[model samples]
Target chain A: MTFWGDYRGHGHPHESSWTMLGPLVVLAVLSIVGGFVFNVPEILSGMFPIKEATENGGPGEMVLTGISVAFGLAGIALSWLMYVVNKDIPEKITSSLGGVYTLVYNKYFVDEAYDAAIVRPLVQGSESVLWKTVDAGLIDGTVNGMGTQSQGVGSLLRLLQSGNIRSYATWVVIGAVVVIVVMGVTR
Target chain B: MNLLEILIALPAAGFLVTLFIPRKQEHLTRSFTLIVSLLAFVLSLGLVTGFETGKPGQQFVDNVVWIANPDIHWHVGIDGLSLWLIILSTFLTPIAILVSWRYIHKQVREFFAFLLLLEFGLIGVFAAWDLFLFYVFWEVVLVPMYFLIGIWGHDRRIYAAVKFFLYTMAGSVLMLVAIIYLYTLAGTFDYATILDLFRSGRIGLSHTEETLLFLAFFVAFAIKVPLFPLHTWLPDAHVEAPTAGSLMLASVMLKMGTYGLLRFCIPLFPVAARENASWINVLAIIGIIYGALVAMVQPNMKKLVAYSSVSHLGFVVLGIFSFTQMGLDGAVYQMLNHGISTGALFVLVGMMYERRHSLAIKDFGGVATAAPWLATIFLITTLASIGLPMLNNFVGEFLILQGVAQAKFAWTAFAAIGVILSACYMLWMYQRVFFGTQGKEPGETVKHHMPDFNVREWLCVVPLVVMMVWMGIVTQTFLPAVSATDASILDQAGTASALARPPVPPTGGITHGGSLHAR
Candidate 1:
C-alpha cells in the first residue's frame, strides 16, 4: 500500500496521533496570545454601541439580558434533545398535536388556498375576461369592425364612380343646390 | 462622404443590392448582406476613432436641405449619447445577419433586404438631427419589422405583426401632430434650432400646451418602451418573431424609445418631464416589480426573456426620470448592456430552438452535461441578466439604484427587490433547464440529440460574452462618453426646470459611493 493511502486508513505509531489537530491547536494558541496582546475583547466591545447601556448597569437592562440568555440556552438545549439525542421525541409531540401537525406539515395548505383564491381566478379572468372579452371582444372587435365598416362604406361608395359624365353632372348640380340651401339657411 | 453619411448609406446600398439578387442564390444573398453589414460596422468604428470625448455637441455632421419649402434637412450626426448606440446598432446588425444565416429559409433575398433596411432605419433614427428626419426614420423602422414579424415569424405572426404595427402607428400619429405644432411654432424641424427656440423662450407655450405636447411624445415612447399596460404587444411580438428579429427588437430597437426620452422628450419638455417625474417613476417601479413577478411563472423560455426585457427597461425609464447624471448614464449604459446580454440570450435560445425545435422549459434537462460550452455561455448571460456582480448588468443596475436612492430612497428600496427576484427566477430557470436528469421519458417519440456550440454558433455568441465582461470591469471606457452627454442633459433639464419653477430643496441627496465617483 502507498504510504499516504495507509496513513489515510491508519496512522503511523511513531507520529503523534494528535498531529492531525496541528492547525487547530496553532489557531487556538495564536488566538489566545493575540487576544491578550491586542486586548481584542475590549476593542470589540468598544465597536458596539450597546456597551454604553451595559456600562450604566440599570437593573432593567440586566434583567432583559438575563431573560434573553436564559431563553437562548433553553432553546438550544431543546433543539439538541429533539434533533440529536432523541429524534423520536419530535414525532411523539407531533402525533399528540394531531390535526395541528398535519396543518404545519402541509404548510397550512397555503399554496392550494392561493391557487383557489388568486391564481385560478387571475388565470381564468385574464384568459376569458381580459383577453377574450376585452381584447378580442371589445378592442379587436372595434378595430376589425372599423375595417369591415370601411369596406362596406367603400362598396356603397363604389356606386358613385360609374363612368358617366351626364349622371355625374346631374348629381353635382343637385349637391350644389342642397349646399346653397343649407348655407343660406345657416347664414 | 462623411463617416455618418457612409454609416447610414452603406446599409441602404446593401439593401438595394439585396433586392436584385435572385431568390435561389441564397449563399450569395447571405454573404453579400454579411459583408455589407460588416462594412457598415467597420465604417462606424471610424466614428469612434475620430470622436473627441468630452466634446459638447454632435460630430461628423452631414446636413443638407432635403425639402426646401418645409425646411426639412437631411441632417445627421452623433453626440456622446448617440455614438455608442450607433456603434451598438452597427455591432448587432452583423451578428443578427449571422444569426439568421440558417434560420430563415423562405424568401432569403427579401429577408436580408428587410434586415438591411431595418438597420438603415435604426442608424438613421440615432443620427438624424432633423425632427422630420427622425420621425421619418422612426416610421421607416416599422415597415421592415412589420414584414419581418408577419411573414417570417412563427405561430400568430399575422396577429402579432398587425398589433405591433397598429400600436406603434397609433402612438406616433400624436407625435407627428406634436412635431408639426413644434415646427409651426419654431418654423423649422432641425432639432438644434427648435431646442434653441424653446430654450430662449422664443417659442413660448403655456404650461398646459407644454404638458399636452409632452404627453403626445411620451405616449409614443412609452408605447415603444412598452411600459406596463401598453406592453401587451411586446410578448406576442417577441415570441412570434424569428431569432434575428427578436435580437434586433430587444437590442437596438427598444433603445430608440429610451433614446427619444433622453433626446427629445426630456430636453424638449423639461418642465413637463420634471412636473410629471413622480408618476412616471411610479409606473417604472411598478413595471420593474410586475415584470419580474410575471417572468418567474413563464413556461416559455423566449417569453421569460421577453418579460425580463420589460423589467430591465423599467430600470432605464426609472433611471431617466431620476434626473441625476449617474441615473442617465446608467440608463444609457444599460441600453447597450441589455442589447448585448439579452440579445445573446435570444441567440442562445434560438440555437436551442434550431436543435430541439422547442422552447418549452420541460423539454430541456441535463443540457449542461450534453453541451457544457452552451451551458457556460448561458450561465454567464444568465448572471449578466440577473445583474450578478462582476458582470455588465450589475454596474448599470448599481448606478441606477444609487441614482434612485439619491432622488428617492423608498423607490430605490423597492427597485432593489426586483434585483433579488431577478436572481431567483433566473437561477431557478437555469437549474431546471440545465441541471436535471437527461432527456424525456423513453416512450416519448422525440429523442434527445442535443449538440454543443458549433463554429458558427460560437461566432455569434463570443463577441457578446466578451462585451458583457469587458463592459463590467472597464466601464470607464464607455462611461466617459455617456457622462458628457448625461451631464449636458441634466444641465439643460436643470436650467429648464429652474427657469419655470422655484428651486425645491434637495431631498434624499446622499453623496455617491464607489470608485467611479471620478465622473
Candidate 2:
C-alpha cells in the first residue's frame, strides 16, 4: 500500500497534490453533513432534554437536516475546486500562501503587541527604576549601616575604658548615685 | 467525652515532653515530636472512622464550665466541617518533623517543640466550640509559627517572619472585635448558642452592622486564605521558610481562612454573606486568573508553587461563595487537594534546593537522566497541581468549576483560563528542570552529577504519592464526610437569596407604578 506522503519523488508527483483534493473535499462535506445532522436536533430541542420532546420528527426537522446535508456537499465541492484551481498557480502566489501561513502561525503577533503595550512601560517606568534602585541601594545600605553603627559603637565604648582622673571622679559619683537610687527606691 | 480536649491535650503532652528533653539531643527531640504527632494523627483518624456524618451536628461535644459567673464554657467539638481539616493538620505535622530530621541542625529541639506547639494551636482552633476558646486558639497558632519562621528561616528570615506575623495579627485583632460584638449580642461565648440565635433571627443586626462584621471576619480569613492582594506576604514566607514550615503553612495554616469563612462568617451573617457573595466571587475569580498570570512569569520554582497556591485556593473560595452542594464539596475537597499536591511540590522543591542551593528554575536542566525517580515524582505532583484528570486536584477543581458554572457561567468561564495557565506554567517549569540536558552540551559532568532520590527522600514522598493517586480515584471516601455540612451551608445560601427576591419585585413595581400614575 502506498502512503499519503510516500509518492513524493520525481516526475509529476506535484500533480498528485491536486488529484488528492477530490476525496478530501468529499470527506469534509460528509463530516459537515454529519455534524449538522447531529447538531440540528439539539438546537431544535431548545436546551430541553430529549425526553421532554413529545415527538421526534417534525417537518421542520426533516427540512433542516436535508438543507444541512445539501450545504455540506456544496461546501466540499467548492473547497476541492478551489484547491485544484490554486494548486498549479505560480511560485509567487504559492509563496504568498506561505507568508499568510507564517502570520497565522505566529498568532498575528498578539504577544509582541502585548509586550509593546504593557511590559515595556512597566519595565521602563520611573516606579520600576525607583524600586530597583531602592532595592539595591537603600535596603542594602541600611543593612550595611547597621553593621557599621555597631562597630562604631563598640569603638566608642572601648574609648570610654581609657583611664583618666576626671573619668574616675565621675565614675565614683555615678556609683554613689546608683546606690542612693537603689536605697531610695527600696525605702 | 468530647474529643476536643483530647485533641488539644495530646499535643500539649508532646509540647511538655519537648521541654524536658535535653535541648542537645536533637534526634531524641525529633523522635518524641514524631511520636506525639503520630498520637494526635491516630486520634484524628479515630474521628474520621467513627464520625457519624449525618448525626444532628458537631460531634464529640466536649462542653465544660470554665467560668461560672461570666457564663463562658470550655466548649469544643468536631463536625463534618472541621473533621478533615483537623486530620490534614495532624497528618502533616509528623511528616513535617520527619522531613526536618536531617535539615535542621541547630536548636533542633526548640524547632520540634515549636512545631508541636503549633499543631496544638491549630487543632484547638479547629476543635474549639466556644468563641473565646476559638479566639485563644487562633492567637495560639501565631506564636509558635512566628518562632518557626523567624528562627529557622533562610536569608531575610526576620523580614518574612515579621511580615507573616503582622499580617495575620492585624487581621485577627479585628476578628477579636467582631467576636466581642457577637458576644455582646448573644450574651454568651459559645459558638453553637451564638449561631442558633443568629440563624433564628433573634439576634438583631442592621444590614450595615452585619456587613461591617462580615468584612472584619472576611479580612481575617482572607489573610489566612491569603486571598489575593492580601497574599503579598505568602511568597516571601514560603521562600524563606524552612521545608516543614512551608509544608504546614501551605497545607494546614492557610485553610484557617476558608474554615473561618465556612464556620463563622457565612453561618453567622447569612444575609450579609448572601449580599456580598457576588462581590466575593468577583474577588475570587480575579485571584484565580491573577495568581496564574503572576505564577506564569515567575523565574523561581518555589515562588511559582507559592503563587499557584493563591490560584488554587481561589477555587476553594469560589466554591464556598458559590453556595451549591457541588461547589461547597469541591471547595472543601480542593482545600485538602491543595495541601497534598502543593505540600509534595514544596518538599520536592526543598529537596532540589538542598542539593543545588538554588530555587531558580534556570539553574536546572537534564536532571531526568540522573534523577529519574525524583523527576517522575515531581512530574506526577505537577500534573496533580495542574488538576489533570485522575489526580486529586482534578476532582476538587472540576467540582468547583461545575459549582461556579451553575451560579454564574461567566465566573466559571473566567476561571477556566486559570486551568490553561496552570498547565502552561507547570509544564514549562517541568520541562526546564527535567526533560533537557543539564549543561550546554551532553557531557559527563552534567550526565552523572545530580544525585537521584535517596532512601530518606523516597520514604518521605511515597505516602504523598500514594495519596495523590488514591484520593484522586476514590474521592467518594472524602466527599461523603463533608456532604452534610455542605448541604446545610447551601440551604442557608438559598434562604438568604430567596428572602431578597420578594423585596426586589415589590420595590421595582412600586417605582414603576408610581411613575405611571404621575405621568
DockQ values, each candidate: 0.08, 0.05
Q: Each model's RMSD to truth, in Å?
A: 7.6, 10.0
- What lDDT score goes with residue B194 in model 2? 82
**Candidate 1: DockQ?**
0.08
DockQ value of candidate 2 = 0.05
Give the local distance difference test score of model 1: 0.86
Q: Say which candidate scores most in DockQ.
A: 1
Q: How well does candidate 1 score on lDDT at residue B415?
A: 91
Candidate 1 lDDT score at position B279: 82
Candidate 1 per-residue lDDT over residues B86-163, each given as its tens digit? 999999999999989999999999999999999999999999999999999999999999999999999899989998
Model 1 Cα displacement at A163 (Å)?
Answer: 9.8
Q: In angstroms, how far off is B301's CA in candidate 2?
A: 1.3
Pairs clashing within candidate 2: none
Model 1 chain B is weakest, by summed lDDT over 10 consecutive residues, at: B509-518
Off by over 4 Å in 2: A1-187, B437-449, B493-519
- In model 1, what is the error at residue B482, expressed in angstroms? 0.5
lDDT of every predicted structure (CA atoms): 0.86, 0.81
